[model samples]
Target: MSPKMVPLERATAPAWRRRPAALLAIALAWPLARLSPHRLRGALEFLSRGAQPVTAAEAEDARNAILGLSVRHGGPRCLERSIAIALICRLSGGWPDWCTGVSTHPFEAHAWVEADGRAIGENPDEITHFFITMKVSVSS
Candidate 1:
């Protein structure tokens, strides 16, 4: 049987917090996305070293910030969004796990951030379909 997928709940943050975070994500995502995968992973690993885990609330807030920014700018692909989330988490004094993976059968690649082992803002089933090729843990 296929696993049930849970809908991600939107996180609420004060306008003051959301606005600035969204702006930062917008500013950083494009440049980061242009980088090659090796460089991007290295950059994320360097930035997230010794970082602490973000709370569930903080994870959600970062997810929302990325979404808001994506809407204003043209939508960024998953790698860009993941990079933005990781950097935003670092700025917030925590970091989530950043991951990149690909799926066969239908053939797709994706990137995402996870907090406490759960993929933030993603369908659990969709994430399960991908096998992770690279990951950067905040604590590493």
Candidate 2:
């Protein structure tokens, strides 16, 4: 028989109960991040080289393709995530590690993958606070 599915009501308790759940997710992602393998790295490099700069739709395709491939083959890592994002930018003619400063947002700074100077993802501005990204020049 198929396993019974638990509803959100059954799974989620309270804010207090969610702490462990959040921690568990981070704990899982941390090791997987560390465990990112060379094969995935190679794939990122390969995809980046093959991908050409294009429009946002093209970039999205590259993002999905590389991320899906990495999840299937590489497991996980910061590199995997960044590379997937970067590949999208590269295909969309945007490079990774691109940065900009926002004077309105308390002098906040943001780095994001871009194509034609447009941010690629939802609220790309949010990335600035989370990661201090540096651009790496990858040889195609």
Candidate 3:
């Protein structure tokens, strides 16, 4: 079946989390995006190793922060966005499952972060059609 594109809602971080630190982390995503995929994944893996499990709420906060910063600074696309989210979580001493996947019918690729097996800021069904190409776990 062809994968359907779902319009995702933007998550908003709590006012308390709208600080310079979060924005700074989001800003760093730009340079990271310039790296090759392999290097990007390796960097994220290094940062995520031995990280604590990120709670749903924490994941939401990071997602929101990324989205917000992206709006203001033209946030990076899927891969960079996912990496940024994971890195933001790492800053708080936790990490989410970073993933990249592709769908065959129309040939699309996407990247996202997950906590407890749930994709953050994405429609659950949207990712079902994708075959995961790479997944980096913080605990691993």
| Highest-scoring model, TM-score | 3
Models ranked on lDDT? 3, 1, 2
Instruction: State candidate 1's TM-score.
Output: 0.82
lDDT for each residue of candidate 1 in 5-123, tens digit (9 for 90 to 100): 33333344437756776677668877988988899888778888888988767887787766654553223366777788788888887998889899986777888888887998777
What clash count does candidate 1 reach?
0
Candidate 1's C-alpha runs over 4 A off are 1-14, 72-76
Query: Which model, 1 or 3, shows the larger TM-score?
Result: 3
Q: Which residue window of length 10 is worst by lDDT in model 3? A: 68-77
lDDT of each residue in 51-109, candidate 2, tens digit only: 45556664444444443333431232334344445644554454443322333333433
Q: Candidates' lDDT values, in order?
A: 0.76, 0.41, 0.76
Per-model clash counts, in order, read: 0, 2, 1
Off by over 4 Å in 3: 1-18, 72-76
**Please, what are the lDDT tens digits per residue for candidate 3 over residues 16-76?**
5455657667677778878888988787778888899898889978878777656542222
Tell me the TM-score of each prediction against the true structure: 0.82, 0.34, 0.82
lDDT of 3: 0.76
